[model samples]
Target: SNSALDEIVHRIITAGLTDAKGETYIPSIVRVGVNAHHSISSVSMDSLVALRVESSDRAKGKRRLEKDRARIAILDESSIVASTLAFSGCSMFSRMTRTFDVVVVDEAAQAVEPSTMVPLCHGCQQLFLVGDPIQLPATVLSDRAKDHGYDHSLFKRFQTAGYPVSVLNVQYRMHPAIRSFPSREFYDEGLEDGPNVVADTERPWHKHACYGPFAWLDVRGKEFTPEGSGSKANRDEAEAALALVKDLMVRFTELREPGLMAVISPYKEQVRLVKSLFRDKLGAEIAQGIDVNTIDGFQGREKLVAIFSGVRADDKKGIGFVRDERRMNVGLTRGRSTMIVLGSARVLRKAGPWRRLVRDAKARRALFPFTRPFDKSIARLTSDTYKVEDEVYSEEGEDEEWEDDEDDEQDVDYGAESEPEGDWIPRAEPGMSDDYSDSGRA
Candidate 1:
């Protein structure tokens, strides 16, 4: 839906609009919304469009909206009016005396009930709430608030209450190999790969077994929490992930573009560590090409390649939020052509879904060990003449095969008490506002 909106906005900005009488003219569009800190008022509108930014100075914005009413009325008649949920309920829009024939909320399941209610307050004959309740819910921090159902989204409430839901079963985002496990494990095998995805989702790297559509690198690394930090990170895992990313970019020139690859972790600290490592090892300009984010931050987004760093390797502490099935689903489904998961099999195998994921990877011949001298292991796989049937080399190019004998061991039932080692915090970089939201959601 966002893609469709982006295309519409691009057309209006570049080629203007054509009316029924073969006349074309530029149209006036206004985007009214603010990000978490009110720093970014316009979400994605072009500079040509008027912006009514919501901020502390509400009267000024209201006056600006009033002056733009004629243009707004023209947009209402010929095009769509776009506004954030919070801004839609602001007094500026209420004073416009405009109602819509239809209203559609994208990613509605990520918004709390009250937030979803904002845009609906405006009169609309038809309403569409587009979201998946099975993914991450609203990010409510207070346990007391959650107990009172503050985190439950209106979309989830409706789905749980047996309201009619239209399932968009056809997914065009992931390669079939990458989509198989999640579809069977989470969606009851109801999800189908689009024809286009099946034909076009294969990448040049897929020729190597290690870089196929789906794979899991067993990183038996130790996880540690930094002093005064409320999250966990695994240096070994971060290095291994970085190595894989570098190998891919070096071997394939087409994959060296920004936003083509992403690194996702369940822990904020892991994300921070990976980003720091990327900048230090790959340099600032080149590192900027790859996105590093937390699992919840990467929802509703996709890339050509995704590297997942599961920072929990402690058998006693269990897997932390990495055990959340919904979060795992989001991480696994984000890569369009390649999904490589880096984790400790000994730790991940304790959870049900994760154990199945590792087992599935092994069954598909996509499991590999992140041995010492990790760079060489990566190089072996990315070599121009490397063949998939090269006997599966490990450290020093020694022959090795991944074993899963421990998969049958008794499973541990970790309770909710086994929470993460540190409290979750919003990611912040130097010279950036602490409240800056990078989740790419309104």
Candidate 2:
């Protein structure tokens, strides 16, 4: 994931610091001289500012036309610039007789065998291939080829051959409640949440007694509709999800950030429905902060909160795209703290993995009915301008402690909900253990 790099970039831009350690790169000059050119090696704060101004200028593209072709050639030939080369560029470079010190490939599990070889053939002394095979396999069009294991990525092949591999056990992404199911079901309870994620992080969903950071909403009434020639959509689930979005937006105003909350589903048609409903009810400004898309659209991205709209509610026919356990694995792990699932429990219980999740949510007291009482909570937000946490001490009286009324506690009936019995829940294949060892040899 780019999460590690993203955090580093965030720190650099905010602090104008270069080194990841305590050391900082301080330039002697704050502003570039009129005649003197800028350094190309390290990017400074001034370079970022220049880039921003250049990018915003409407005439920036036109200015390229004014420069002479020979002048451009001269500028290009003057410096040896380093840049990120794509897979095509790596193949082209491999044709030449150049040698590299080290080559690092991130997300190597998604790359095909031949594509991974292109970069390895660059005469690099050391190569680092990083990714998890359990997340996604390589795409193979031919069924025969896939049957022979063409779909297995180079990383998976290496792992299967008894090659040394390291597993990152500490996950700083999801909260313990959200991470619990995936960790036990997928990683054998190997994943551990960082201390800060459990302590410092505030989950606004905790205000709801029944629903913690992880919960499921029952939408067994929804019906799937055929979209285009292949996809499907569910109007009932989409509407319920939209209502939950409205409740969260108006009630948790402080937790709202642009793209902080996302609505993800397996079907593209359902994604569109939720997006349209979200835009219609919440308006553009509030809707802009929420992302509505399919499960594949959300990989490699994490948020403070997420809602999964499993639109498949058919009884005769089983869960269509939801049958892919990998998609469910990726979706369950995306939420940093809170995750709400709205789907047909009856329909999902037919599937192996979905049934397991449905059962886990119920056992943890995180299950809620589709038409559960939300009016009382939403009404409180509509009438009160200030949030419960926003209350501060005043000269007239001290700040009152925020407490939930008896009705709010009674809203979620954990014991009343019947468990889906006699349903076969599939056991996920155990992945590599959390215990990691360094080979010191690549």
Candidate 3:
């Protein structure tokens, strides 16, 4: 969302505003400034020093305040000023004597109403709130505070009051296959794919059936919670996920790059376990290249490929946080090229949206039952050895070789501790090919 805000600012500075058609009006030259936290100040725009207002001495504090005011005065000269929500309400901004003509809050659906009010209080005549209420809401830690509706956002409030909200119907991030189910289930089939992300714009990995635009590997993994821990982890799902990643890396050379792929889970314990397993099996350097995070933390982020591990498998537990449709929407829509979900279909089918998801995958012929050990099964599917190429070195004018443990001949068993019943595993649809070369267009 910060990127979206930054893009908006950049467009305003470069091309001013444009109409729906291709017409653009170049406005008179105007200065624009952005104020943000020091950590995120390295944005596309020029960075400014974050004002520090704390001081122990009265004289020093007065001088600091005066200097900060001078800095704020520089921003006041700009017709357009952008700042983070917290920075907009800082002491230095409060001391400024200028008011804005318009205030735009990006990601308003994820900000609490009180926090959203901070920028509006700067005497802006018109306001615009930009966000999707269907994705995720503001997070409230206290149960009591949540009961008092502290998590309700101003964007949702306006929508609830029957405001005329304009919907942006075309999405450019996800492939058409990856966007289909979420569009139909969440947006009442109103969302459409942009021209750039259609089936013709397929990535190289799309040639492999298993690495198609969308697929769900039915991992009948059992979930377990550790002692003194509230989060859950599934060893089977993690192994399957790792095996998928390994296969992708070996098959496609581009996937080896960092930040191109991500492995997300709903539980912190599962994220920790997946990271550890990746380090152990893939080695620390390769593992460090992948992004592993919780589903909540991965919101508003996209990757070339995404592997989601649904860690809740017990029927009695009834799918835990996976049942939250908002979180599900965010998790399902994060992949730009490919989206692979590993979970127990039996348990996920108990929830309404998940049931529809599973049914949709089956109907699209993208659902595969993962019943065998990942190493052997993936090897059979891809017909490729699960080994990384070794590096050669010539040190001190002598020919030498560098060997990696991952390239060793030792066979490691990365399977579930217990197998599920045969009835729980669904057979692949008729005419489905096990060959990776087959295009599995969903």
Clashing pairs in model 3, backbone N/Cα/C closer than 3 A: none
Q: Which 10-residue span in candidate 1 carries the lowest summed lDDT?
A: 408-417
For model 2, residues 302-407, the per-residue Cα lDDT tens digits are 6667888877776666565576677788778767767888787766766666767867776675665555344543354334352434322222311211121212
Overall local distance difference test of candidate 2 = 0.56
Give the 10-residue window scoring lowest on summed lDDT in candidate 2.
Answer: 416-425
Candidate with better TM-score, 1 vs 2: 1
**Clash totals for all candidate models:** 0, 1, 0
RMSD of each: 9.9, 15.2, 16.3
For model 1, the stretches where C-alpha displacement exceeds 4 angstroms are 1-31, 34-46, 49-78, 383-442
> What's the lDDT for residue 138 in model 2?
61
Error of model 3, residue 125, in angstroms: 3.4
Q: Residue 169 in model 3: shift from native, Å?
A: 1.4
TM-score of each: 0.75, 0.67, 0.71
Best by lDDT: 1
lDDT of each: 0.69, 0.56, 0.67
